[model samples]
Target: MKDLGMNLALSAEEKSLLELITPELVKIGKDRSKLIPILQLIQEKLAYLPGEAIHMVADHLSISPSEVYGVATFYNQFRFNPPGRNPVKVCLGTACHVKGGDIILENFERKLDIKEGQTTPDREFSIERVACVGCCALAPVTVVGQTVHGHMQPSKVEGLVLRARIEREKQQREKQKNESSE
Candidate 1:
């Protein structure tokens, strides 16, 4: 894998992902018909279809990059970029909207200093709006990683953001301490 010369050394996860994608691509065969299946397999493994992965898929299918991307764009399930370390998703389903979900979304954007669909410069977090998260009863919900905060109000967003920041800082400090000790 190092001999492939992509310049940047592949992370452990990246190397494992490549190993997973390579065989599946081969087993499925290199045809246009397998494009979506290939994309699905990649997304299932990585939660997103990266640029290099897209190029590899195109090459395998004997299709142009535009064609591969065109098919992927038609599907909303596909994400082109990797998710942030902490993904913050605001629900915009009908129930949530009636409960001021839009306001909650705006509050997140303002606090994070990045609009929806964008990650912070430090890549500590990302913000996205989703149609539903199966918590309609808990309208105006915001999900950060695996934790859900329901009945969110614009005024309460600061606390949520601040708590996440504090928790992440603590984790970082602990990690540094452990590494230094080692």
Candidate 2:
């Protein structure tokens, strides 16, 4: 008898989504065949790939864990760590490159006091760079959460970040006020 490795149990929500994907995985035959979409599904369901889930998926599909890790690392869209409550992705694509993205990124690095791929000490923000966001015409653009600021200048970077911080503080204060009122 061959040991098939550890079996993974999914949470109720994850199981439901996996069941929906079971047909698709089955149709693909090998786990390798289903690997990408499977990963995507899990990421969508769980926000990030749990280590256990990755191992389970690898075992089920007869692939090595390293292979799974490799795939996960290769894709920028996929996040290995749980993203911050707010994730800031600065686009460094070619158009942005010429538009002083380097300076902007540096400013963020200095102001945030954290390198790229790092979250703030308080965990209120996480900074990262993307290859291209297709807003090159606006070059030197920064995306804070979902909002994008284009044509950014070196001098404007600090102000933009400060503005975002102030805005967030305002929202938090407003929420607190509402809670007290309630």
Candidate 3:
């Protein structure tokens, strides 16, 4: 995609959100001290900070792009990319590591063809590794959406992907059936 500068070819919804936030940004004014708050505000409003929003914030704050990105990256709470429909978090805590958590994470990455903290092209899945989830007994744990899979194996990742695909297909079929019935 070509560099879209401030607009970034944002969706209609994104544009509307930008318009709504623009006034607040003007109120906040350009201050280095306000950077984090601005980022948080944008994330809360847009779910994730889009490229255009970041640029707009940086421009409004009279800061460099690197400064904005640097601050955003420093905080784990900030998510640069949009989330997928399904958020999968793999635990990499000490217990999980002992149980081959890395193996499980790699399996998920290979299966989804996306690295940790990435969403798939179709936005069907996103997978990331967490330091700990306070469930050591559930070592090698994988959390897909709100469902926790304990004692997870690399093979289980395949089954999970397959199941998700099946479920999505089922939903799509049902929607199509309903449309045709109408």
* Candidate 1 lDDT, 1-182, residue by residue in tens: 10112222345797688777797788899778878888999989877776678788888988898888888877778776556788999999999999999999998899988777666766677788999999899998989999998989877899888887899999999999999999
Cα lDDT tens digits for candidate 2, 1-182: 11111222334875566556556656666746678888887788766665666776787799898888888778876765445556778888888887778888888888887667766655566778999988788888888888888888767777876887888899999999999999
Q: How many residue-pair clashes does candidate 3 contain?
A: 0
CA-only RMSD, every prediction: 5.4, 7.1, 3.5
- Candidate ranking (TM-score, best to worst): 3, 1, 2
Every candidate's lDDT: 0.81, 0.73, 0.83
* Residue range with the least summed lDDT across 10 consecutive positions in model 3: 1-10
Model 2 reaches what TM-score against the true structure? 0.65
Pairs of residues clashing in candidate 3: none
lDDT of 3 by residue, 1-182 (tens): 21212222456987899789999998988788999999999999987777887789889988888788878877888876566678889999999999999999999999998778667767788777899988899898988988899999977899999999999999999999999999
Candidates ranked by lDDT: 3, 1, 2
What lDDT, from 0 to 1, does candidate 1 have?
0.81
Which candidate leads in lDDT? 3
Candidate 3, residue 73: how far the Cα is off, in Å: 1.4
What's each prediction's TM-score? 0.84, 0.65, 0.88
The residue ranges of model 1 lying beyond 4 angstroms of the native Cα positions read: 1-12
